[model samples]
Target: MASFPPNRATTLKAAFRACDVGPLVGADIERYYVDLSNVRNTEAIESLNTRLDFLEPAEFCSILFTGHRGCGKSTELRKIQKRWEVEYKVIYIEADAEIDILDAEYTDLYLVIIKKVADELNKLNLKFDAQLLHNFETWFKEITQETEQTVERSVSISASAEAGGQIPFISKLLGKIQAQIKGADKQKQTIRQLLQKDIGRLQADINLLLGDAFVKLKQKYPEYEKGFLIIFDNLDRVPPNVANHLFFDYSEQLQSLHCTIVLTAPISVVYSEKNLSNAFDTPNIVPMVNIYKLERQRGDLEYNDVGIKAVASLIEQRVDIDAVFESPQDLLELVKASGGHVRQLMRITAKAFLTAATRKHNKVTTDDVTYAIKQEQFNFERSIPTELYSELAKVCLTKDVPKDENGWLMLFSLWVFEYNGKTRWNYINPTVRQSDAFQEALQSITANP
Candidate 1:
């Protein structure tokens, strides 16, 4: 029932424009955040809040948080940042945006974390030991001789633009290195390969800087008692191979950095062959917001009123539902089709708006909603291999996701929705369930069973 900002009376085109599909960030996030803790089973955010609140200021820990790509993991992480901002100097980094995410290594992550913490400390007018940073800069310079010309040019330009001391200078140099690491694959590989042999020295130098930075920051800002809390977000966007390498193979390196950290991992890692808990703590999973009635034995899916209203409120916060939708029923149908994925709901609603606008309808109608749903169905149908349809049906019939590649694939593709109840359950996506492939598979299972 709460109103969102940038709210106004508008034309159909403006209403369509208001329907943004990207993950909410910066100032816009404040307007659209909805609390789903009561409706969904996952307690990732709450558990994180409690743990971080109680953690010692200088103690280091790593926590893995993951979920489906568009299922609001970023939004939830941002919420955690806000809640802990008073106690921690949170350095929230979007890993993919900063690094070549698919090819990122543990060494690259260490450099990124060091650079970010230094950047944040500089903002607070805090400085680390000059000799420590000089040693690090010299070591990097020795290895980066091949790219000296380019690195010099970048640092020179940045230094001229922003005048500062040693910490700022190192920050600028690391900024250039970070840029090269992200921009050129060859450069990234060179940096990683060079650092591979000297990882101990690299980590040792960074830790020296971290120690100094932490001391200075704690001394300067008494309120920031917890020091730095680095959140490496969107590491979840990496492919499975890359995820396994980063979160599984090099998990110790990922955790060894001398600060509390939260990394977003791919959900598949939970079911990976690796014993993730052995390397890091048990991962915090953000499951889909359950929007269906519970059935102990799998059968036909039905809607849950509370879950339906929770998803519906996400849209109501952004646009005037009554003005855009022909009726509440039409809105409900669109929400049901989303299967509790936040971005999918917005994508479907955006499509419905486009369909209505294209048809010259004053507002969205049932036909518009159906057309939107069908378009999404086609999208899922194309991505999902025909061979997997039966597997999806098995999930729908048995209320269980197979612990095989096919099940993980369904989950990754969002063709199957995972939710927690008395235990975890998987169901065919509402729209995907309506596809001919799923219907036929369901019928085949029913007839045979």
Candidate 2:
């Protein structure tokens, strides 16, 4: 049998050869291929499809699509948007890109929406009022003191001069510009109030402009059934404070629009704040598609087998797996350790493949998979704060559940424990709960409270 020397290079080469026996793909594997044959959670997809179907008949339906990070939420959103575009005039925007909305300001929020709407118009080669563009220029100057005029700055020019006063490009450009500005400083605070007034005026102007356009379009194409649908994806990426304002404070205005609005947000955003629940109380307003419930079993061979097959299918589209792995089982081991996180699975696979390729191994084996996992764990540790683990340890040791709602929610959301064959919010690990420090902390908190 071939053996490795005690040296690091020799050991690495041996591991690489082992990995080649049945190479594992890492989390860094390309997502496009993995996501191509996306196994749609039938229930989640059906609910969303039902909403889209309803919206197609000139009805408004708002949905809050919630899932953990890397759980394919964005991919599903894109799929829905693409499918609805033929029937409904779809405009998709990312809320995280709107920086100014975090301060609980409705004006900045409106600006972002308007700007996104204008961008859609521009893409469709539509035109709108020159006067509105000029108004936007003046409003832009008043809000943002920048004097330089670029394609972005001349939104009014694009909206009015390029066509008739029918396109709302200026409004959309203003939203983009407003979203770029950060925090409610004294200067921005003053500008914000002024901008709010302009926003009201701008909204009125847009309602008239868009209303006229809708009428004209309907007159021209009597067969067109739906009005428009604007999807705001990645609202969860926004600061929670800002997200609350966008979803809660201005919900009515959003609903009242002649178009349908769909928002994708973290599940926590809806449940974390009482105000959020109160503001968005309409049961039909935001139908939720819980994607978190679809998590696959960790360390299950059958589960890993399916995931590996998915991963292999993805990798095969970009590179030759036969040249990478001796057999499929090599890849299966890596998938088993990945916990079904697509990104993590890809990353592990990629690293293992790279390691094997460097060592000129014909097939990856178990040893290489182990090495790749170690490498991934090392890289992951570097990105995460060292203190976070200590905090987690403290929580685990104390068995002291947090009193604050946010803190408790954070613990659950962060996946601090696994219980009853599913991830839940209880500290059931005996070893962790048995820690003296944990017990003491729990006593102290109980006594203090």
What number of clashing residue pairs does each candidate have, in the order they appear? 0, 44
Report the C-alpha lDDT of model 2 over 1-449, residue by residue, as the tens digit.
Answer: 12322221223333333322121122222222244234323345557778678654545656666544444556566667767767767777766566543454555545666566666656556555566556556656655664444435545555465656554436544643563456437756776666666666656765655554455445544444575677776665555455555667676665555556776655445445354546553222121111122223211112423434664554454444555567767766665545444445556766786676666666666677667777765554443343344444445444334444443343324323221122232232222233344445556644664
Write down the worst ten-residue block by lDDT for model 2. Answer: 283-292
lDDT over C-alpha atoms for residue 365 of model 1? 93
Q: Residue 161 lDDT in model 2?
A: 58
Estimate, for each residue in 285-363, the C-alpha lDDT of model 1 and write its tens digit: 8888898887857568788899999998888877787788889899899899999988899889888888899999999
- TM-score of each predicted structure versus truth: 0.92, 0.63
Clashing pairs in 1: none
Q: What is the lDDT of residue 85 in candidate 1?
A: 87
